[model samples]
Target: MHKRTKSNIAVMLVLALCLSAILAGCGHEPDKPKPTKNVVLISVCSVRADHMSCYGYRRQTTPRLAEFARQCVVYDNAFTQWPKTTPAFCAIMSAKYAHNNGVLRATHGPRLADEHVTLAEVMADAGYQTAAFLSSPALAAHSNIAQGFQNVDEVFVGPRRAVLPTIRAIEWLRKRDPKKPFFIWAHYNNAHYPYRASGIPNPDMFVEDQFYDASRHVRALKDPRAHLKADVPRDHPCVMEILRPDIGAIHTWAVLDERPEELDFYIARYDAGIYSADASIGRLLDELRTLGLLDNTIVALVGDHGESLGDHNYYFEHGRFPYDATAHVPLMIRQPRGAGARHVSTQVAAFDLAPTLLEMTGLTPPEDWDARSLGRLDKDTPGDNLVFTEAGYQLDYMLAVHDSEWKLIDVPNALDRQMMRHQEYELYRWRDDPGETRELSAAHPDQVARLAAILDEWAAPWRAEVYANWTRNQTTIPTETSRQLESLGYVGSNSSEDEEGDDGGD
Candidate 1:
């Protein structure tokens, strides 16, 4: 009887252990690894936030971008540290001010120093497949603007639109390694100067008045009698005999004389360029969606810097002034799965982009970077942050200190001039006077003093460091690069003797 009981107990115990194992398998499964997210960064040159349809422009210049804005975390008051392409991009990629990053001027500074780790390097280190497709010749590999990117293509160099880059980016995406996450940067120069409005089949539809093509304007400037046809009425500004071949110079001369009516045509052309860029961006996004990667990829769109558009007597150019028209740019980030869509009015700088992107992608930004990540922005965030904008060689090292309500433009040109005894300051209540028509430096002495002190404290160290190593920081511009700059109407010297005629560094 004892033997029989022992056998029965053994059988029952075996069945209990099997049941426990089955229950454990059914109740809880092991944790699966999280999928890595991909990233795409899109940048357009010379785009003014106010002129974009998504940013409250009356014109529908960026219908596709406006649609994209709905899926993005749009930053309404974002600003760039520098107004020039190379320096601005340096600030964005290095998460450091231009002066600190060693690329303070376009076509002049040494390629971004290898010492500072770039966003591409970080992404690459984090196991990302990095690539950069840029449309600006100024950003060619020789300039080191594509630092740390494994694959780079600057085939469509010049002021071309986003078409070629978009196509190339799509092809790269299709052929990229499916197992590894990728980081792709596509920079478009469509909205930049000459404002040719090229990809649009019918630009006249976007213009309020007659469409004046860029070539027509250029021809008229070269030889008024032969090129300026009767269509260019006597009342039109282009009818005037301007010796300069660059449209920007002629536009500056005309607008300064209060002949701004013709500017409307140019503005319309600029809008059309934005429209072309928007369409190209739309196509790229559509491709992402088609490939089943839209939800998994983070899409970041921004303007490297804003165009002057005749503001502050700086026409059709940037990097010459630190006004809001040139400093304020469009910044939007489409989070993965279209999450976190909201407008952030808190002031932010281009440098913040690097760290923000790094944080969003689950990577850690370098501890020594001068930027703070904006990934945690919310509706109640304070707007008290001070954003700084620095001028390039064109402005003789000017700086603008901005707060939520006031902006102070400090031009220390006197330091370089033997005859001048005092610095120049221009203060404006930017909130109430966005146009900045009324100067307040003379009226608000206290504000100027306070802001000036802040500006000097913030800029002094960087300025000292930059000038201390000026010779080592300069680079020789290649002949082909000079030709590219000339084609884009961005060639000139940084000599005070030729300051009156110099127009290229920016």
Candidate 2:
């Protein structure tokens, strides 16, 4: 009996040893750590900072954004490198000025060169999955805007609304590798011109019967030149009809001309579109939370550019001028793990976004990048006060520089003779005269010269290389893309040069 017991014990000991060896092998294998963070960049096109309620606007156009801002670092004064879509996005992605990226124009010749490193490239190189869902045809894959994105979806069938894109983004997020980080860029194109008021709350708040007539008449005007190309003839039938007593009465009561009231109506429509966009964003945020990804994700909301809304006599759209109306955009950043909300009033450029995001993600930005991280902005960190802007489309070549209190705009000889007749230099104490109605150039000759010198020195290197590079690698957009751009007032001929009859601006 004792011998039998010893044999049984030996057999049991061998089985225990086998089990211990198996457990040790399993423990030796490395355990994969869960990805700590994800990034979602939401770019809202043509969204004016002033229109949002959080920016002191009376309208509740962005209740959702207002709530989101509570958990974000809200930037009250954020400016774009260029007001147009392509150039502005390039600046954000490349962390470079328009000159460095060599994308001066909205379309036609200047495309984002291959040499420059994009934000997508940087993230992808760092082992993050990069994807982009663009609503604007101006940012199509062929535009070289798809440089480092592993996946790009620009094929939303109808008017580029936020709903479809947001849905697609959520779906992509659900399928993304749980163990890997991701960088997703989604562009919302709702606040653009030809504003659709469908599904907007309180669409009739600013509605006037005559305003509708004026809007319809303005839309019916066949002459493309009358719309955004240039100032319409005061005596033209469209103008006369709009200014007629039946249509102009409500408009003329506030301002001497019909323009002020007409603009009021247009602004109402624009606000409605903004409201819709805000709702869509709220939906996206909610979905992220529902999917248990909100806390681990970094949410950034910004505008590519703002609409003019009749500022500087340039009505309806953006990209035409360098006024605060178009240049100043809203920027909001929500860090992972519920970082507390803070408002940053420092004047920062859109290019700073790339570096800021990189630093936030525990990555190092390239030293040569024009953008600097705003990581210490909450600590009252001091940075370069100067913000530069440029526009080189068909209207007029413009360069501008602005500090906290002053702004200087230099319009080189216009491509069109009519535009050339306008002033070549404009200086404004923007703090006092936010409208930029008063030109202080003559009054402040010394300041003008000083700013001009700065601009010239800054632009010299870019000017030397831009034209040559643009001519060397011009991209011809597809016919379908051209038609889409034309519908959005980016009309031009099909040639590699400037589109014919394309009085480029916003």
Candidate 3:
């Protein structure tokens, strides 16, 4: 009987050890947030930071987002790695440069390669439900922009609206698995070109009604010969009665010379578009709050790129220029339970977004990412402050580097050099001349050489690899996507050495 009692006690001790081992295993993963915590990423296409109310614009273009910005960490000088939609997003999602990620243009471009792990994939692997609602064909599944998203809802149907995607996101959040956290991305194309802000209360606040009088204003293509002129008379009448969805890039610039006041109408329309998008975003935030997810959700807002409103004569376009008009964008992050709500004024790149999201969610970002998390900025970490921007849509390929006060745009393409009167480099003290009106490359030779060397050293390796495999990496756009891009004015003729052609805005 004593022997039997000894064996039972030994079994009890072994059982106790097994129980403790299980409990310790559970406690080891305490760093990861519970499944209740969620993440929401909101991206707006072609939103210029300078045009937003929160950014000090005269008009209240983003009333909803401006209020929302007060509760978030706003990056005032954020720039995109690439100004085009596909390349910009690829850089953001992969934490890599556009050249390295293999997505160079919005259409007829290389898709995001399968090897690059995206943010959605990371969150999904962490047992979070990952989804994306996109309005642009640039982010279509076939383009590989939907790489890591498990559920993707694409709206390619013409007349893109932010509300469509926002509604889809709200619906998905309502029906998501309650046991798992969610990582959702909602991209709005309402701020994109052919700005038609349907449902916006007052989109024409800054413009006179006479500008839209169809009886007086006519929509007609200017003589192809006048495309390059910096100024033309009112007789040219570059203003269009109804801005067609597929208007050419050069035509918009022609408006600057003729019917200049009419530009306000288009600008107002753009602002209205922004306001409409803000409302849709407000609705999404409301849904999150109603569902009791706001307390646990991390919300982030970013612009893929900005639109040029007559900046450097690239009116109402993007992707072709390396100017701040197209490169600077808005970035904001609202942490869970309103933690870390402050403004970060230093320079930040869109590629930094991946690591920022990862670190915020209790996951360690990979050390090799090209950009670092903005958290380092919040903590005043001493790190690289130089931000880079590249352009390869339709114009000559260019590379730009920006420090806190200086910006250098290096246009190395031979065609571009000849076209710009043999001027190959442009240096702007952006803080003083945000318009980039005064070219100072000749005056600031020292600054130009320093930034040019940095850009060349950093880009040489990737540029060589990209050029060598450019043809192989290029993907054929699906038929429907091609149609959508064509309608959106992205599928236009390329510029030639002899004559300035369409800007091929994306």
Task: Highest TM-score: give the candidate number.
Answer: 3
lDDT of each: 0.72, 0.70, 0.72
Tens digit of per-residue lDDT, candidate 2, span 1-506: 99999999999999977877787788853433333578899988888898889787777789998988989989888889998788898888888887777676565534678888888888888889988887777787656867888999884336434466687788888898888899998888777655654334564554553434454322222233332234445532123212211111221111212243454566766777788778878888998889888878889988888977656545565565778888889999998655967887778887798888887787778877898887756565334578898863432367888877788988874432233226778898876886678888889999899889989898886665564444433577778776665543344422212222121222
Instruction: Name the regions of candidate 2 deviating beyond 4 angstroms.
Output: 1-35, 198-220, 225-261, 376-383, 394-396, 414-421, 464-472, 489-506
What TM value does model 3 have?
A: 0.82
Point out where model 3 deviates above 4 Å: 1-36, 158-160, 209-261, 378-383, 394-396, 418-421, 492-505
Query: In model 2, what is the error at residue 116, expressed in angstroms?
Result: 1.7
Instruction: Give the number of the best model, judged by lDDT.
Output: 3
Clash pairs of candidate 2? 318-506, 492-499, 493-499, 493-500
Error of 2 at 439 (Å): 1.9
Per-structure clash totals for the candidates = 0, 4, 0
Could you estimate the TM-score for every candidate? 0.79, 0.79, 0.82
Q: What's the distance in Å from true for residue 118, model 1?
A: 0.5
TM-score of 1: 0.79
lDDT string for model 1 (1-506, tens) is: 99999999999999977877787789954333333889999998888999999999888889998999999999888888988788798888888887777776555435787888889998898889999988876676656768779999875543333488788899999999999999999988777655665666865456554443433322113221222122323432212211122223343222222123456666776788788888888899999999999878999998878887666644676665678887889999999777979898777787788888888887889887888888655433465588898874532467887788899987775532221114388888987887777888778999999999999899766676565554455566778766555443334421112112211223
Candidate 3 residue 17 C-alpha distance from true site, Å? 15
